[model samples]
Target: MTMSITELEQALRALRLSGMSATMQARALQVAQHQMDFLEAFSWLVQDELDRRRSRLLDRRFTLSGLRERKDLKDFDWTYNARLPKREVLALGTLQFLDAKEDLLMIGPPGTGKSHCAKALALLAVQRGYTVLYREAHQLIEDLAEAR
Candidate 1:
């Protein structure tokens, strides 16, 4: 009562196991020739599915995030704005306040990295699998006014 590889592949495809079905032939060959265990081969196929799903999810998140460019919190230079509290800015990167349903305000004079920091935080939120909508201060105010 053994199933042929073609039958198994068809069954896997019918079950929507594209990742497993696509790699099944090569993986099965590896298992037979390299003495790889069934569990190991199965896990690799599962990992491929998981990785693909995760990447697609991340892409969707980025597209909906309204982020024009990727910003890195680590790239921020603390030396330029010595007066700015570095710890406070870095703490925002952790995004704990998001869980508590809190809002953050970044206020500073021009050329003080306020926008950079805000964008960096937005990037962090997006990377952490949170929905982010970024808008300029004036743009946000205008939207609010229109809503009124």
Candidate 2:
């Protein structure tokens, strides 16, 4: 017996396959249009579920990271500060220090993109499956004091 789309979606939801359930209607339309075969449709459904789970995991990580902005290193204005060590900043973006288990300290005068760069790097680290805690120097000191 063929299952109705609603029944199928209900079953998928029961199985906690939210991603597949969410895409099932669209995939069904594609199937009806002969745009996808059974195997292809099944693969797409599985991929959708995986993508949803991955996205959710990233979201949770970002929430736990205490990062307010979704910053990227590419958005930094290299031309604005010609004296900035572009090479070093780019190297930090590579995240080698993470593997080396080292800490970073970005010190510069006000309005020199210190916080911007740090936030960008922290965002990258969170995206790359790392847990991060972002805080300003004074905030860190306050947290330390509060802990004592």
Candidate 3:
């Protein structure tokens, strides 16, 4: 027989009270606490799956170690330049755009760090549990061409 939400919550509570570690208790608590909001709980599960996929795609071996080492976004000069107000705004806007599921466009002249900012934002997105893809415009075009 299928279990109801209250039954699932009771089972989870039992697991938590079974002398589990703090970590396990916390995990069990989340399951028990969200039983009433199944849709939100399901969305979190889907987001977690997407995050796992993105992590696999962005495995350390595949990333530029040097770029990944830069901890502060301010270290990049383009992040400060006055000419590109919109890109900077967009960088800041990522906070507002968290889990927004919208396309982002960054356009600029060559050597302007458009790619850098995009990479940084994509990294941030992944950290915030959103799925992300980072690719050069030319490479994406070529990929589409090959697919056709």
Which candidate number has the best lDDT? Answer: 2
The C-alpha TM-scores of every prediction are 0.77, 0.94, 0.47
What CA root-mean-square deviation does each model show from the true structure? 3.1, 1.3, 10.2
In candidate 2, what are the lDDT values of residues 1-148, reduced to their tens digit? 9998899999999999999999999988888899999889989999999999999999999999888889888999988888889899988998999999999999978888888899999998998999999999899999999999
**RMSD versus native structure for model 2:** 1.3
- Inter-residue clash pairs, candidate 1: none
| TM match of model 1 to true structure | 0.77
Q: For each candidate, what is the lDDT?
A: 0.86, 0.93, 0.57
Give stretches of model 2 more than 4 Å off.
none
Clashes of each: 0, 0, 0
Q: Regarding lDDT, does 1 or 2 come out ahead?
A: 2
Cα deviation of 66, candidate 2, in Å = 0.6
After the best TM-score superposition of candidate 3, give how far the Cα of residue 70 lies from its true spot, in angstroms.
6.3
Better of 1 and 2 by TM-score: 2
